[model samples]
Target: MADFVEKASEKITKLSDEQLERLLNTVREENKIYDSIIQSIPSGLVIVDNNWCITKINKSAKRYLHFFHLHLIKSDPVWNLIADEEVSNFISFCAQKQNTNTNEEFSIVSADDKARFIVVSILPLVCDGKIAGTIIFIEDITAKRQQEILMHRMESLKSLTNLAASVAHEIKNPLGAISIHIQLLQKSIKKCREGDGQLPDEKFMEKYLSVVNEEIENLNKIVMDFLFAVRPLKVNMTLSEPDSIIEKSINFFMPEFENCGIEVSVNLQGNRNRLLIDEKLFREIFINIVQNAKAAILSSKKSNGKLAINSFIKNDHYILTIADNGCGMDEATCSRIFEPYYTTKADGTGLGLTTVYKIVKEFRGEITVNSELDEGTVFTVQIPVPQKETMLLEE
Candidate 1:
């Protein structure tokens, strides 16, 4: 290739003035076309030398630079144009590792003091098997990022609306029952006053009162559950043993488990290291899940129902799993198990799993369920190990 270039150079020098002029004109036209292509690109393009000096920039890049209150000057350090220290540092790090391809997204405040999101991609410019510089592609993704955020908020608003509707529906049923019972009681008393001037029969009065009382209790429970599901939890982070909490929660329900003929098996061999969590909320997590499992077992009507709990550590996270050999849920049910006011049981408030989900998320953890109809279900919870403990374990 070197010899060929040398021959070509000699031929170029040997050309007559007229022919050379024609050749130069053609070369200049081709250069103009290349420049036009670069300028026409929508995304910002910048070329920087090995010294981090801006060598060439398209019109789009210049416009972006202007936003940053920078000018397109020859041999200007590219870092000087970046207002974000983190972004500048990242670019420098990437440039140091030649031949590296990097794509990064970050937010910057332009000269107008308006926040903008920018995506940057850097590619190595190679010459003679060595990196001579880098080609940077910058894209202003402020509009796109804002659109995504707006869409997410809209989705959240839609979910909130659905939740409100469910709450109203739940309250309406019990409220309607209470109202009917009250009206009946009023009529009975009015008839007694107008006819015999005597009180209503004890049994009839008791029946109506009991119905009203039960309906009121149901309404209270629904309100409480709704509040618990929506209220921001007050988390008190503590380093506590998960096994102990699990044992306590299970023991609290031992009588019910025995009466329902559901066998409970537990294996707590996970991280011996205490987890950083809220003790009350963490216990609630176990209680809710165990209650859910017990209900599933009862629903299955299994003669030899079994509830199994296990714990282990993997990938710097503590994993707690509960499996029940009970009537399982279908895919649709499983998918919405964590949604507010979603339940399969007649008496279920539908907020048990929702509360569990919120608690797990408070700990920066994750929960997942897998089940098949007529089979069984498994709920897996993963809580990240505390940073200090993880570091100690690694050591």
Candidate 2:
């Protein structure tokens, strides 16, 4: 390719004035075509030298920069346009690693004082086996992000509607039982009055009242769980070791695990770095997961059930995984496990995993479940490490 280019250059130099004029016109037309393509792109496009000075920018980029209170000029330092410290720092970091490509999303309050989400991509420009400059692609994703939030709220509203129907059904069963018992007690009292003016049997009264009390307690519990699943959470984030929280959650159920004959194993590798999360909420995540594992094992009716807990750090996120050798779920069941009041267990209120999902979201984390019928199930949770912790780890 290099030799072909050199030969073409030599030939061009030897051309007559008329021929050279035609070649120059053709080249200028090609440059115009290229420039038009750049200007037509919807995403903001910018080209900067190694010193972060803008060499070329497109119309979309110019308009986007104006939102940041920047009036761009050729050869201007691009960093000067960034008013948000966080965004500036990120750009600086990308500049330091210009040889590699970087993609990230950042939130900034624009000059209009409105919060906006932008995706920034930085790629190195290579010429003659040397880094000549960098290409930055900026995209405003605020509208897209808002739509996602709106969709999420709609889904939550749908879940709440389903929960309302489930709650009514759940309450009706206990209420019916209490009403039936009360009618039986009333009949017993009427029989006593008609027979010998004697009172009902003491044991009969205790038995019926006990059932009524138990049903009322169950009703109370259902309401409490429903509230917890739907209400907003107050997360108090503190730097805490995830392994310790995992251990504590496991220990809380150790007796039951032993009695159930489920062999439990834990391998913790994320303890070296601490995560900023609510300790209690984080523990609840594991507790619900572990409890589900135990239930799955019992349902499998296996003589020897194994539960494995593991944690590690990957890609600036702390990952925790729980695997159980139990009767796993089908795809349909797995998908709805996080829905409110959706459960297969005879006595399950079905809000345990829903709470887990909410807490993970509050932490800016993710939870996923993979399962196969009668084989096993694995639940994985990923929580992002704080920026300072990630930088220290990288260093």
Candidate 3:
């Protein structure tokens, strides 16, 4: 709190008695009006002393403190009430800031609970150019912040949806045409080789047919990837075994392992393997990732690529990590790896990773990539487990 006497003395000496009395009366009336306004304000307001103790609190501030089991006191620690590092540091710094000059806003949690945002301002009172205590204003803008986040999320979803639709529309026709050409080439080969009395263009025809088949397969993969992104499905949410998903996908990729000279190892943290996931889509997710691991290992030319697949239950989510000691991607390559039609290989479809990304998003899960050039890449997927109600229904 500032010294009212010093503040009064500096200006009072220059005024007559009648003038001073009128000024004092006007000040008192203004204080009453300000108190009324503070009480009616939606957000909390607390004026703290130099030591960060509550000096004066409005009605809203009192209610907020009571809800969070805090009391107004002198010389008490403001940081102690808000046990978040960001908030504590912000207030400690703001307390030293000149209120009239600096205006700072930061997000603060509610008493070591969840992420509750608050915008705090420090306003200083000065007497004759001397430092005085600060006045703190606390406004709860949690709902507004959440609304902004929701809007951003909606926009991202819309953009992704539109991209998927465009890719599907553009790639479907080409894929169909490629399939027709493959069928026609196969028929022609069967007809031309039927009367093989030293076929004239047999060698050239074989080479051309092989190239056509390879390209057709690649185009089909591209089409599937596009369809996976554009197509929406109703998820079957259940407590699924994470390790089983990994094992199944690995077993399915055994042929790839033989071809690529790769070995896979699994480590399950505990018995908890269940997650709320769609069995079919989850299988697709694992296939895409494991296949990627095989490709990376093959491309690197390592004697045997070591792929470590692991899953663990953490918090309210199930986390799965697929790590491969293959030729890892650089930062630039990793950034666009999930984008549709973005491939590094000359003959690659560039849709495998895109499909993996879409499946992860469908489950409301997050997938993060960490990779370095030549070292390897580790992809972490976090998927939320079904709640008890949903789990029971599935059972």
User: Which residues of candidate 3, in runs, are more than 4 Å off?
Assistant: 1-156, 160-230, 255-259, 389-395
Candidate 2 structure quality by residue, lDDT tens digits, 5-51: 34656898688898777666766777788899999998889888878
**Candidate 3 residues 182-269, lDDT tens each?**
6766676677678673443776566656666666777676677666666665555433566776676777777767776678788877
Candidate with the greatest lDDT versus the true structure: 2
Which candidate number has the best TM-score? 2
Candidates 1 and 2 compared by lDDT, better number = 2
- The local lDDT score (0 to 100) that residue 59 gets in candidate 2 is 84
| Candidate 3: Cα lDDT at 329 | 96
Candidate 1: which stretches are off by over 4 Å?
1-21, 62-72, 96-99, 109-118, 128-130, 139-169, 192-395
Model 2: per-residue Cα lDDT at residue 323: 99
Compute the lDDT for candidate 2.
0.80
TM-score of every prediction relative to native:
0.46, 0.47, 0.43
**Top-down TM-score ranking:** 2, 1, 3
C-alpha RMSD between model 2 and the true structure: 11.5
Task: Give the alpha carbon lDDT tens digit for every residue of 1-395 in model 1.
Answer: 34543455579968889867866676677778889999999888988888878877888765554424346445456776766675676677776665356566555565456666666777777789988888888787767655654563354454556777888999999989989999999999999999989999899899999999999998888787677766767765545678888887877888988988888898997445566578899988998888888888888898999999999988988999999988999999899999767788888877789889988876778899999898899999999765420111110
**Candidate 2 has which clashing residue pairs, if any?**
none
